[model samples]
Target: MASSPTELPIHRFNSFDGVELAYREMGEGRPLVLIHGYFSTAMVNWVRYGHAGKIADRGYRVIMPDLRGHGDSARPHDPAAYPHDALADDGFALIEHLGLTDYDLGGYSLGGRTAMRMLARGAKPGRAIVAGMGLDGILNTAGRGGYFRRVLTNLGSFERGTPEWLTEAFLKTVQGDPVALLNVLDTFADTPREAVEAIAMPVLIVAGKDDDDNGSAEALADLLPHGRHGVIPGNHMSAVTRPELGIAIAEFLSE
Candidate 1:
């Protein structure tokens, strides 16, 4: 039988680089730390999507944290404030702060990339799920960096029928600090293909069926030592909210 941990009040801890991070914990069993995507908070990625509650019901203590520059965490707009693998370092810091040895980790989009880089940096979990990223996405950072930069600086007008136009419209709706997010672009990780392929941890790769912005999740899984792929029904923006996404993650982590 799985056990539940007592709910703790909001906690604040300094990340590896001294940046303050905010996190909340619920239920209990094995610890599962979930990272939200860029421009989104833990609340949006897990709580609103039902992943946190569903996972908690499954008897896992869910640890959801706002990444360094997003949500309730400290948001620094200076590019120098953002550093390599900064978010990953925050995740690891939370693990150590809570003294967790046995746990699972998962993240959506930017969060997933952070988790992958954490693994690349020797942070190990019982299992990992990289959601919303693919092979080409992780290997190539130049284009993404550029897109985000434009998303931060240019609100003028994206030419119709262009990716920039579509993305700008989405970014406009998200309640995130644009300047801080811009700095994040300057600091986003460019993890090597070899580093990703070398990860020996069992990983479940989840992506939307129609999300081509990133590479293929299935193809990326093939490159991993113990990777598998699952698809939810929507495009990138909507897939994270689908019930299937939570179900797949809970089932995968349970195994």
Candidate 2:
């Protein structure tokens, strides 16, 4: 059963770099950190999707952080500033800041990529879940190239109004500075494929049947040392929104 929103506790902490990081904490057992995907905030990705409360109800202290440059965190304008290592550092700093050890970490899309980077850097979690992501950090590189081109071409339309969910999501996030989006793209470009294979911890890889952007979950599952793959029946957004995904995640972490 899902816990009510009013029952959860939300807190904010400052990262080493001075960015204010916000996280939602709930439940009363093992600690788990939930990271959001690219262009999405923790509130939208986890709270709105019912992931925070759902996971909390299963006897785990769930922490959902708003990554730097997204959500309520500080947004630096330099494109070169948002490297994967820096992102990993932020994760570690948050864990250390909270004095947490042997906790679980989970992420989706860009967040998943960051979690893998953290593992490669020796930040060990009891278990990890990487959803809507693949071994290759780049989400459909060949396709993304063209897709980004279209995004750039249709910037005017997006700026005006496009009812397409993905487009609207992108537009909603890409505001303030196009450089931040480009920085994210460049950061993903530098993600090492070997990092996925280097992760020594047990991991759950979840993907939507229609999540063509990140490749299939099976592809991601094959990269982990110990990985379990599952497919939800929806596109990327819906996959995260559905309750089954949260239940599967909580069950996997419990094991």
lDDT at position 59, candidate 1: 90
Local accuracy by lDDT, each model: 0.83, 0.73
lDDT of 1 by residue, 1-255 (tens): 123232335679988888888987777799999999888888778877678878988999989899888888999877778887677778889999999898999999988888888898898899999998887778776676776787678865778767777776666666678888887776677779899889998999999999876778888899898999898888887899898889999999877
Q: In candidate 2, what are the lDDT values of residues 1-255, reduced to their tens digit?
A: 225665445578887666676776666789998888877777777777777777887888888887777766666778656664567778888999899977999898778877877777788898998887765553334455345546644555554444343565665664524445545554443345676677788999988888867666797788677988988877876787888788889889867
Model 2 vs truth, CA RMSD? 3.7
- For model 1 the TM-score comes to 0.91
lDDT of 2 at 155: 57
All candidates: TM-score: 0.91, 0.83
Error of 2 at 187 (Å): 3.4
Once fitted onto the true fold, the runs of candidate 1 whose alpha carbons sit more than 4 angstroms away are 1-9, 159-166
Error of 2 at 103 (Å): 0.3
Residue pairs clashing in model 2 are none
